[model samples]
Target: MNLPKIVLALGYSGLIPFFIGPVWLGFSPETAPAWLDRAWLSWAALIGAFMAGTFWGFALPAVQGPAGLLGIFISVALVALTGIAVTLEFAHALAGLALVFMLLLLADFWRERTLDTIGGYFRLRSTLTAGVLIAITWRYLMLPAGGA
Candidate 1:
C-alpha cells in the first residue's frame, strides 16, 4: 500500500491498545489477571512501536531522513516512558507527560504540513490520534476503578 494508507493503518492500530489497556487493566488494577495485564501492555507497546516506525517511514522522505527518524524515536520514547510511569503508579506525572507529548505531536503535525505544503493527510492522522486519546481517557479513565 501507499504511504498515507500505511500511516493511517498504523495510527488506527496503535489506538486499539489505548482503548483496551485501561479498560482491561487500568480499571481493574487490583483484580485483572496477571497474564491479561501482561498481554494488554505488550500489545499496546508493540502497536505503539509499529505506529512510531511507520510514522517515521512516511515522514523521513518529507523531512530529509535523519531528522524525521529522530523525531519519531523521541515520540516513541516519550510514549513508552510515560506508559511505564503510569503503570508504576505515577498517574499525575504520566498525565503531565502525556499532555506534553500530545502538544508536541500537534505541533509536529502542523509544522510538517506547513513546511511541506502537504495535503490533509496529517490533519486526518492528528484527528484520529486525538480521537483515540479522548476515547481512552473518557471511556476507560472515567469509569470506576473496577466496574463493568
Candidate 2:
C-alpha cells in the first residue's frame, strides 16, 4: 500500500530525538551532561507510551473478540512498563525502554500480519525500531565501566 507522505515523514523524523542522546554524549568533552541520560530515557519512555496508544487503536475494531481484548490488555501493560522503565536507574532504564520499543515493534508486526495488513507501515516501524535500538545501545556502551 502506498503510505501517505506525512506518515513516512513523521515516523522517520521521530527518530531524531533517539539519535540525539548518543550524538550529545559523543560530543561531550568528558562524561555526558547532567541531564543527557535522563533526557534520553524520558524521550524513549514517552515514545513507548505513545506506541501503546497506537496499539490500543489497532485493537479497537476487534474489541468484541478475545484477540482484541488481549491486544488492549497488552497495550495498557506496555504503558505501565514504560512508566516503570523511567523510574529505574540510567543503565537499567535504557535497557528497559529498549525492550519496550522492541515489544512495540513486535506488536506492530502482529498487527500488520493479522489485524490490518498494512504494507509499508511495518517496514517503517522496523526501520525506526532499529534506529532506536542502535541509539540506545550506543548510549549504553558510552556509560562508565559499571554503567552510570
Candidate 3:
C-alpha cells in the first residue's frame, strides 16, 4: 500500500468540482454581478489548487511520520470546508462533492489496505462517510423547504 498513490487519487478527485463548477454555475459570468462571479471563480480555483496540493503532499517521498498525518488531515479539512461551503448555498453541489469524495476515499483504501496501520485508511474512510452522511441529510433537510 503506497501512500503516494492514495494522495494522487484524492488529488484527482478535486478536479471533479473544477469541471462541474462552471456548468453548475450556468457558465454565464454575465448573468451574475461582477463581484459574485469573481468570488465564485476564486473559490473554484482555490478548490482546484488544494486538490493539486493534496496530491503532492501525500505523494512526496520526503514526507513521513507526522508529516504524512498532516497531509491526511489537510485533505480531510479541505473536504469538510468544501462541504460547508456548498451546503450553505448549493445543497446539490454538496451532495455531488460527497459522492466524489467517497469514491476517492474508497479507491485510496483499496490501494493501501496494509497502510491501514499508518492511520490513513481509517481516518479517510471516516471522513468520507461523514461527508456522505452530511450530504444526504442536507438533501433531505432541504426537501421540506422546496429543495427540488
Candidate 4:
C-alpha cells in the first residue's frame, strides 16, 4: 500500500533497532556490544509508549465504549511495561512491549471511524508489530542460557 512518506519513514525507522541488534549480534557471539541489546529493548518500549500516548490522545474525544476502555487498558499496560522494561531483563521487556502493542492494536480496531484515511494505520501497525515481535522473539531464542 502507498502510505504517507512520513508514516513509512517513521515505521521503518522504528524497526532499525530491532533489525540491527540481532543481525549484528549474530556475528559477534563472543563479545557483543551493549548498545545492540539496549537498543532493541529501548526502541521496542519507546514505540509501545509512543503508540499508547497516541491512543490516549485519541480516546479523550471518544465516549465511554470499547475503544475507550481499551485505551484505559493500554495506558495501564504502558505503565507496567515501562516499569518492566527498565527493571526487568530484555526478554521480559520485549514481552511487555508486545503486550502494549497488542492492547494498542485492539483499541485501534474498536475505535470509532473519524478520518477518511484510517485503514492504512492499522496495516502499518500490523506489519510493524509482526516484524518487531519476530525480531525480538528471535533475539530471545538465539541468546545464550541467560543472555548476551
Best by lDDT: 2
Residue 18's lDDT within candidate 2 is 93
Ranking by lDDT: 2, 4, 1, 3
The reply for model 1, stretches above 4 Å from the true place, is 1-10, 22-32, 47-87, 90-97, 100-104, 114-118, 139-148
Q: Give a tens-digit lDDT track for model 2, residues 1-148.
A: 7789999999989899998888877886366677876777888888889988887888889889987887898799899999998898889989898889888988887777666556687888899899999999998898889987
Write the residue-wise lDDT of candidate 3 on 1-148 in tens digits: 5447756587446444334434434555346454542354345435523542554445355246654555565456555655554555454554554554554455455434422344454565455455444534533453336554
Candidate 2 structure, TM-score to reference: 0.93
What TM-scores do the predictions have? 0.51, 0.93, 0.35, 0.77
Query: Per-prediction count of colliding residue pairs?
Result: 0, 0, 0, 0
Candidate 3, run of 10 with poorest lDDT: 110-119
Model 4 stretches astray by more than 4 angstroms: 1-3, 63-73, 112-117, 146-148
Candidates' lDDT values, in order? 0.54, 0.85, 0.48, 0.69
Ranking of all predicted structures according to TM-score, beginning with the best and ending with the worst: 2, 4, 1, 3
Q: Which ten residues in a row have the lowest lDDT in candidate 4?
A: 110-119
Please report how far candidate 4 places residue 142 from its true position, in Å: 1.4
Give the candidate number with the greatest TM-score.
2
Compute the lDDT of residue 101 as modeled in candidate 4.
Answer: 67
Whichever of 3 and 4 has more TM-score, that candidate is 4
